[model samples]
Target: MKKAALLSIAMLGLTACSQGVQTMTDRTASPCGDKPNCVSTQDNREKYQLAPFTLTANASLDNIEEVALKLPGAKTAVKEGGYLRIECTSRIMRFVDDLELKIDGRTLVVRSESRVGYSDFGVNRKRADQLREQLKQSGLIE
Candidate 1:
């Protein structure tokens, strides 16, 4: 009975940590939850809201894809049409965070959220800011 209970708990933990692509439409990314572990350009909440990237005339989804892949511990999980999802793993705890991007005309929508956590210590926000800086430096975003 104890073994069974332990196994069930282990399975639950694993499930909570599992990473998957969030649904994104043409100009919308998934909204962040009430938790402090998320930040998104689509979220209107003051705490979770972030400014969307302004894409230059020459900017392409491919350019965003390249810059996203350059982020530390980032791996492409899905890339279809104008939507891209990247999984970023923490070097210490291996906690996975989902970073999603959607190209909407001349704007780029972005979201970053932890897969399993109530508070991410501002990791998601920092990641989004880092991405913004990188994209700016690459002449991709305004």
Candidate 2:
């Protein structure tokens, strides 16, 4: 009985930590939560807000996808219309973080958030910055 209860609790914890794409919309990536574990181009909070990537004339969703996939532990999980979702896992703890991108006219909106933690130790912000630099290097974004 004790073993069964422990198994159930473990499953519940994993389920909570594996949530994905909770607040995305057709036109934008999801907003950052009140926690510091997120950063988004659509967020109004100074600490959580990042500038949307300005797509160059030659840039496409394919270019963005290719650039994003080069990030550490990044894998494309969803691609539909102008939206793309990439799951990035931490190397040690294997914590999954959702990195979402939405094409909006000449720009790419972005949101990166941890699934379960209150603080990601700036991991989400660093991931976004790394992606931005790669996009710029590839001439995909200005």
Candidate 3:
């Protein structure tokens, strides 16, 4: 009877382990079985990749704002103590609003939703035709 009870408990443990198992697709996205330990990209999909150009004033939000805007990476920044929304893409990333001045640090958060990726930022982009014309006139391009 003890042996049978041990086997039943083992089976229950195995079932519990598989309860929340999930599967995710990578860049190639072939069906891959994700274990229970797998972290869902959307369910746990809040992601950020931030580095400071120069963190001064003890990593307050303001100091880090501008340089991050000009660069390819800053996923988000604090402006006017409000969240500055940005969209990113491989070709270009653009600002969602004019600079807000609430930030006082150098560390920036490069974050995104599960449905959003850096490449999706291109949808909102427009080329700088004026700059292109200037460059052409300057003989920078044929």
Best by lDDT: 2
> What TM-score would candidate 2 get against the native?
0.83
Model 1 CA lDDT for position 93: 81
- Model 1: per-residue Cα lDDT over 1-142, one tens digit each: 9999999999989875665446533334567778899999999999999987899988888889899888989998888988888889989888888888888899998989887869999999999999999999999998
Between prediction 1 and prediction 3, the one with superior lDDT is 1
Q: Which ten-residue region of model 2 has the weakest summed lDDT?
A: 20-29
lDDT of 3 by residue, 1-142 (tens): 9999999999988764542213321211111123221111122322211122222334444333433344343344223452343323333322221111222233222232222233323222121222223323433323
Error of 3 at 71 (Å): 1.9
Error of 2 at 5 (Å): 11
Ranking of all predicted structures according to lDDT, beginning with the best and ending with the worst = 2, 1, 3
Give the Cα lDDT of each candidate.
Answer: 0.86, 0.87, 0.30
Q: How many clashing residue pairs appear in each of the predictions shown?
A: 0, 0, 12
In the range 1-142, model 2's lDDT, one tens digit per residue, is: 9999999999988786665555544434456768999999998889999987899999888889999999999998889988898989888877888888888899899988887779999999999999999999999988
**After superposition on all CA atoms, how large is the RMSD of candidate 1?**
3.3
TM-score: model 1 vs. ground truth: 0.82
Give candidate 1's total backbone clashes.
0
- Cα error, residue 79 of model 3, in Å, equals 3.1
Q: Candidates' TM-scores?
A: 0.82, 0.83, 0.25
